[model samples]
Target: MRLSRAFIRAVSSPATVAWRSAQSRIFCSSPSDYRKSQPSMLKHLTSKIKATGPVSVAEYMREVLTNPVTGYYVRNNMLGPDGDFITSPEISQVFGELLGVWIISEWMAAGRPKQLQLVELGPGNGSLAADVLRVFGQLQSVLGGASVSLHLMEVSPALSDFQAQTLTGGGSQKADCEEDPVYRHGTTAAGLPVSWYRCLEDVPAGFSIFVAHEFFDSLPVHKFQRTEKGWREVLVDVDPEDSGKLRFVVSPGPTLASATLVQANERRDHIEVCAEGGVIIQQLARRILNDGGAVLIMDYGHDGTKTDTFRGFKDHQLHDVLLSPGSADLTADVDFSFLRRMAGGGVACLGPVTQGLFLKNMGIDTRMQVLLRNCHDPSTRKQLINSYDMLTNPTKMGERFLFFSLLHPSRLAAPTKPHGLKLEKRSPVLLPVAGFTDLSFS
Candidate 1:
């Protein structure tokens, strides 16, 4: 299944979107405010604040993004030239193709698991999945007769429909009961089975390659600001001046999240902590430790150096984060350091390398030249060149986007045998993780 994660679709805002070339909701109302008429969401948020005396920014984000009926992500078709932003896979096939190679590289490094599960979180329109599958089909010999299946975790019904159509070519079915772990099932154009789940907890256990692109950024982050009185969590409150609007306010004293989520020796005056993101990372680490697979994440992020990256996007232009509830995309730069810490010591964590270096390491240059040689049309060639530039240009998506990974500890160490009191292993030369190091290509 495929859709555009093409170049940034919005007319502006480059720093916030690299996978968006770099990277809304409409409420039903009058033509001018249709996208802004998130009546249910607005009323719910205000009422909750009125009752609880304001809510944490994390709580606010959770409602605005994943609130089932009217959450921004739940109701909108917000990708492509028609939506707020576009993606790399939509810009060019090379992006996903290289990712596909990385997946295979990891699989091979893991000794080619008998059953290969390709699980993608929040696969918008399935464009990345489709591109990866195309590569899988082309490299059939490399894959041998291994069993391969696709698993996608997504929430938007509209985007799921797009994913089904894109991946299955109209050949898919919905689960008979809502209680089923898999809500939908189908076979790809390549005849590989595909299943859909609502959450990561529901995905069937197996050796799986988990990939999340621009997913972590959407997870709710608890914002905190240090004060003379100590750390105070940021809360969203009903605007005193305008009941219809919302505003950022600080908690009076340390709350549960501020007490625990923030580090004791932290130096930053302000911080955005995604406890939910940490929980997800822990789950992934647990899975990798138990099932022997890998997790590859690509997104707009930093190595814990950034502070206050939360912002909104609507129709591609920057939107006020608290202006219209459920009417825009809200995201923050992922803190890879936070993820690494949460991954714990059970599995090996790899680079949060710049997207450009990662792609170049994965042989993007060679792949580009190969594609360019096979094409003759001037316009297509120009488009290909532009797409290549979009992905690799240091100023664009390249420098802004990052690739981070989690792998089984065994991936780094040779197989060991249990001795009387300890484990013993032979010194085997293992291939370095793809994209993280040039040794992968070498």
Candidate 2:
């Protein structure tokens, strides 16, 4: 699809226009002044693009959404009702509560380790963690008072502060100091008391539960397009016209370095390599295989054939991936196939399940029904329905978001191969008989 004119305008003057709209409530403004500021910005952007070669979609998105100082994520509050978009936990308490239940279940299945590590990647505002812990506290007696050590893998200091605040508030509400969760910050493998020389090596050897929601998609991705000659890797460089502008340009790099790019060459033009995300997945899988544990990956993606899934988001609206320099959100779809393959042997990989189906299977509907039973006002009831729809409606986020689970081999009674490993499916009789119930319910 071609870039929209509206997106062009937004990208060109994102700072002036987006900031004004975002902060409008804080500082009321007249429409006339806003209109006057737009043309100049467009002219500047047009001149810059002309001087520079056509920017790639990825380059445009990286600049507009993630520019070090002036990027949207850096300058704006991009979460909750006031921000550009809302995440699942931000949408409702029940979402996190349910996820907590899942984690507790996994913890129990791991034989209830004495020193259990609960880790979250890119824990925005830590709302999900707080909610999960609240539910977890309620089930502590059954799960046993397992020493809980909370670790958060976050990059942004701004987000770290927000996470600290949320954890503190939630921890205060818990019954006692012993029950209060310990908080640490760094990459999933870094922040925790784990030692490793490399990214994959950093994962501490232990029975741990890992959760990453809306995390993988944000990692840097390499874009590629197939041609008669071969596939090429995309790179970002500064645009000459606008001193501060950056644009996507092809890099003369070997495609073999990127497995996804090498595989995508057989397909049509335009593909994305989330090699970074895949590497992280492999690391997690290795951790599970070598030590023991489970990982819950939740994000928007597909379980179908491969295709170009790179895109951008600004102020809750989709925009051309190549619109601005470091000012917008740049992301590519998660390839569960790649993850499944990377997990290799001896791992039980489950579901690229639809968020709607998974949540429903996990009792979201039952929870909603319970809430509606006590809800007295019609307006409040309607609001609850809307929230549910936002979460589960296919066109909304329900079908779009996907959930995948990776479990340790020892925990599963059956012999299982990782996804995409080309292993033959065993018969029901031959398969391990340990059901999901064999795992402890935290």
Candidate 3:
């Protein structure tokens, strides 16, 4: 969820744009004016606002990102160097490798079911999945890799195609991919089977290992601002002075959101609540509770709800969210407290620990040193060092990003307390878990 600060740049100036235009004309044969290629989303949004008076933030985000016709995700290249932002998987293979190891360990802890489903939410370009699969392939001799299957929950068809290409060694024949009404199935480069579902509900019932890295942050959240009287739900509306412009407007009175405020008396005047996030958490909890498995959530957010975090990113730079609606990526910090509450009783919540501490305790430094020794190329070595630093540095992604775990109590089979999660104060035996060995729950 934490973007690489080094890669982040301020919005380009006029001179920079001129240089880009020249470069595009020279190096690129055909450059499409992205804005002109599609109908104006602003117009559509303005019309909606006119009809409805104002729209919820969630509605705006959902439509802006997934409008099917004019959505940002449908038209924009949203990952890697060419896109708006980069994910941890895109940063380095090491990140995904560690995650793969974690999944393997969790699988073993879950008793190594004969059939295990490895599910990833929002599998962008399938980079993480590829890396994880590589690890699984390497350990096939011991773990029986054939027992595992990869299931991805992806909505964008274009991104799905990109993921298919990446998983099948950068190029895949159209004939190899099969799609039905429910899901799409294919084989990876190493012949490992995979499937893509439109939603979590589509995945068949089974023992699952769920990974949601930077997934929940993108789900739209309702913003509420406190006034002297009470809280008012923020809404997006067309500016009165400038009809073409959009702005945030508070409701006339306190809305339904005030009922769920955790810190009503807190000095902070703003709060964000993602009802959709709650619903999805409930679904995940039910899936894992009924069918024994575990879930790993890695994102950037506070333990509780916060405010003024909803922002947009375009071309690796932060920008005015309303400037070019539906063009930039919008995301907010996840409230781990809300996730924990939605998990209910059957699922045990783990640490909402910083990603830096998790990686350090998991021996990222040791792994880096090992890789450094075998590397001959100076550039590759330098890149590795830089990525390592960026990932673990407190100022960068390390401290900003958080790691959380949810496990089914029955699957763990541990006589002692579970790892990472806060345990009863009087519990004498706390079982140590890898990567969480040093973590102490007070």
Candidate 4:
């Protein structure tokens, strides 16, 4: 997008920079300041480290982001305009609408399965789910009145409450036991069955289309650095000089992860392995292979090309990751190459395609034009245009975010011909289906 003074001012804002930029640690305060500011979490971490020595970055992230009592995600409703960061779904209804269309499109290609469970991992505020559900309602006839249900995998009670309120209008009932597979249940405003789970494994197996937007990036990652001796795991340790804070330190010797996670042929001097993300991908792959469905993962990530992407965000500005505990959001860029490998050979993995290209292939431009044509309010129309720019502009979210998928192997195989019909050369699933193909749009 051409940068006007207004555009420059907007993108240069703390919120935008924090969400999209690659910045180094900005230590505005003492590393130990976290002890005074958020002592509950920081003290807990410092105490743990004092007792047990350095912890894995993965463990540190798990505690900081989802520590049940004091973690950021658990204690804060930190998303959207008024919070830590904003996501594409919050930027435009068109974002969610296009994805919703893709979900239904995939379902149709699967021959309208008897049961369709729309599963979302880390559904933030349920905005995406609401938009997808709306699209399903609009295409009821195309769905052939198929049994459709919404299954959400969320770990934050605060966010789940918000999601339940947003999607079901405060109608969901919490499960009696936290151990129950389904932790919550509700009927959407449109009367579709909706259920919530704390993990993907708890979601019942079915012909499900899994959607994860900006989800995998939050999974904890283990950082490693190569030394003359061998690869060593980088761990989070309480800085001896500043007992109130944390810092990264390399293991003195090889740790189990350093030995097991790093590939023998790996050439990078520095590497980060998200074993947790790999496990999730494996689960998704196994589900698609056995039960017949697909998985779509969208996030800001690298194709295993980036190193040292771990950082923190608070109120839309970069925060020193090591300085504070449980006071900001922590994340890293997902390594698509690792995920693809973990997916194994059974499922066909599609592009880690740029979000701009994927959405355009999914017909985002056409969708935008239609929305503009229907809306009459000047402010609303202008907002729609700006949102379009923000979402698709290459230098903005468009390039930073990407779309990747895992489909049942058969989805890409030659289509079986009906009784007397001729067999097409390309798989129907590859013909402009889900934007993985380069489809020409009018």
Clashes of each: 17, 18, 0, 0
The digit string of per-residue lDDT tens for model 3 on 343-422 reads: 77778887788888777666577678778888999999999999998898999998899988888876445633333333
List where candidate 3 sits over 4 angstroms from the true fold. Answer: 1-39, 169-181, 257-267, 411-433, 436-442
Give the alpha carbon lDDT tens digit for every residue of 324-380 in model 1: 778889999999999999888878888888888778877788778777888899999
In model 4, the runs with Cα more than 4 Å from the true position are 1-38, 415-442
State every prediction's TM-score relative to the real structure: 0.86, 0.71, 0.83, 0.88
Q: lDDT by residue for model 2 over 1-442, one digit each (tens)?
A: 1223243333233121111111111111112212223333234444544555333333344455455555555555567766656799988887887787667656665666676777777787789987877776665675566666666675454676667666763222211343223223222211223111112334446677888899877765556655445665454343444434334555343333332235642554666655556657767877788777788889977654656787767678885554442334667788777677667666888778778876766667777887888899999999889989989998988988888878876655734432211223323222211112111222
Q: Per-residue error at 153 for model 4, in Å?
A: 0.3
Model 3: worst 10 consecutive residues (lDDT sum): 9-18
Per-residue lDDT over 154-235 for candidate 4, one digit per residue giving the tens place of the 0 to 100 score? 9999999999998998789998987898989999988999999998888998999999998988888888888777877777
Q: Give residue 160's error in model 4 in angstroms.
A: 0.5
Q: How many steric overlaps does candidate 4 have?
A: 0
Best by TM-score: 4
**lDDT scores of the candidates, listed in order:** 0.78, 0.58, 0.71, 0.78
Q: Model 2 clash tally?
A: 18
lDDT of 3 at 299: 95
